[model samples]
Target: MPSNDNTPRADRQELAYLPVPFPKAPPKEPRFAALRTWWQEAWEEDGVLRAMWEDVLSAPEDGFRYMAPWLRAVLMVAGVSFIVLMAKAAGEVVLEGLHQLLTAVPKVQVGGDTSSGVFAVVDQPVRTYIAQHSAGLPVAASTVYTLWLLTGITGLVLGYLSRNNGVRAMWAGWGAASVFMVWTATPATSRPIAVGLAVLAWTVLSAFAMRGLTLRRRVGRPARPARVSVKPEIHVHVPAPAPAPVVEQHPHSGCPFRD
Candidate 1:
């Protein structure tokens, strides 16, 4: 269309340097709306959070009992070790070649000294294959072993910290230990008794651990600070009492009206 103005149509053309508004953006939802909704839902009369809060409030505090503490401690230690061994066995099968592949990388080194001890016998055949098959990849047997040991210790500590209850802690410790064990163990017939014990321990401990983790997350969480609600107080003032309702002078006598 030709411009009605005197200026040239090119000069009159409006330049859109700024970004064009994008379809009004569908009115983005407020970020905290979801949080607020969740809070309201969780606080409902029959809600899970509400029930948990009630249970905690009503539950009686009990004194700690040291029943079979020695036995329990020994069991937990054994359970964790067993879980780690099982993890190693599983890793050997699943990781197969990748396990050795990791050894080629210096960072994946299990230990610094690999000449003797568990490292020597475990994965001896696979270790040879890793060396011969690779293209000059330096392998440190001890490094891998050390890494596995560190992982197990770390997991054991974390598992202990996760649960306050002794029974739950035992399970949690075993479950965590299994995770670290994957890096260290090789499939072997040695320590069959220990292996059998591990299988039993893992079955029992892991089952309990799963339940504790899934259902008792709130139980382990730190107590939330009580909400301090501040209600606004309203104050109203009536102007100076309107001169106290003036009494009219009585024409009959000296008495003034009392009503």
Candidate 2:
């Protein structure tokens, strides 16, 4: 038992400091932390391919902008164009394919009449109206293909120059495919306007893709540190002026002049 100051002296006791347990080791990061980080980063990003897929699935910040336009201008224009082009291309492709195919393989028809076919063929008034203007085609497609040599070459060169192997491979493959497609389809395009339309679509799509990539590149990159300019310090030697002497005066009762 300890005694108070007014009581008898007590035995001295050793002072002890607080015992703090070491901080628990920070939780171990998961083995696939890098993958998890990448997934987190990529999931939120509006990548061009991902955005396109989202658009297709009708999944995005806005489900489909085309559906809810206040003016409905784009929707109307697209609808009209879709109807017109569908009607025209439907007949044009069939007639042109049949016309070209018959010229190429006249015996593909069962009898003198072009009604029945050894292969699938459009029948009747279609065959009668258009025969001399076109010959039967082997392929049945109204596809238009156009490739810009400059664009493909530039993409290939840039891809090769890029640090990423995946990007390099992508551009290389795309360029080769574009060349092949344009080569094969250009000759087969029955209409003169198809080539022009193909060029326009190709340009427009490329512009959109470039715009998206440019935006991503700008947004994803880390900001650079701001530079600070340092100016040289100059020392001036202006001397302080000397203090003026102080005069003391006292007034005497009879000697005011002398004081």
Candidate 3:
């Protein structure tokens, strides 16, 4: 073997040209510039990015300015109308049936002779119907009817006042009455109808109360006054047109020739 001093220097020759086993030129900096260009091109092709940007820029700062008041007004009107409709339906459908039942009582006579007095000639069938059905009611049917009447009157007053507290109280009373009817009364033909009216009344009252709260929240605080700048008017004075351009000596020569 040659002397140690005669050994070839590893650092002297070009490492790139040599058959080295390591990676070539420490991986070139990724072409981020080209990547950015491709990304921009893709965005343009879809148009999605452009539309999103435009929508964001065009959206109002105060989105609820117009929407809030409009919504509140609509809800208030609707609530009032719904309450009225429920009241009418209850009176027409449920109350009317109660009226018919009450009317049957007076028609019942105790005996055939008018002088025998009304109680003596009472209609047997009507009295029997009342005996069988009224017993099932927690309270007398007359008492229940009175409770129902009170509920309607209270509900009307509360709704007119737009007082949620009053409305809720009325609903509580009405709900109790409805439960009483369910528990004590035999399943009369009118049971389902009465239950339906009770449900409608409860729902309308609850919904109207909630809508009132929503309206209060949406009204929010008063808006600040806007500053306005008024600009002064500018007036311009235009000079009169110059007398028809004078021909000077040419004009004088033409006048002399005419003379």
**lDDT at 27, model 3:** 57
Identify the leading candidate in terms of lDDT: 3
The 0-to-1 C-alpha lDDT of every candidate, in the order given, reads 0.54, 0.48, 0.55
Give the per-residue Cα lDDT of candidate 3 at 69: 52
As for TM-score, the candidate ahead, 2 or 3, is 3
Clash counts for all predictions: 12, 8, 8
Where does the lowest 10-residue lDDT sum fall in candidate 2?
139-148
Which pairs of residues clash in candidate 2, taking residues 3 or more apart in a chain or in different chains?
A: 99-135, 99-136, 100-135, 100-136, 100-137, 101-136, 101-137, 102-136
Q: Return the top candidate by TM-score.
A: 3
Residue 141 lDDT, candidate 1, scale 0-100: 49
Model 2 spans with C-alpha error above 4 angstroms: 1-176, 186-192, 212-259
lDDT (Cα, 0-100) at 82 in candidate 1: 100
What is candidate 3's lDDT per residue for 7-40, written digit by digit as tens?
Answer: 5687556447666587668757666988787668
In candidate 3, the residue pairs with backbone N, CA or C atoms under 3 Å apart (3 or more residues apart, or in different chains) clash, namely 109-121, 109-122, 110-120, 110-121, 110-122, 111-120, 111-121, 136-184
Residue lDDT tens for model 1, 80-134: 9999999999988878766664565465433223446443443343343333334
Q: Which ten residues in a row have the lowest lDDT in candidate 3?
A: 118-127
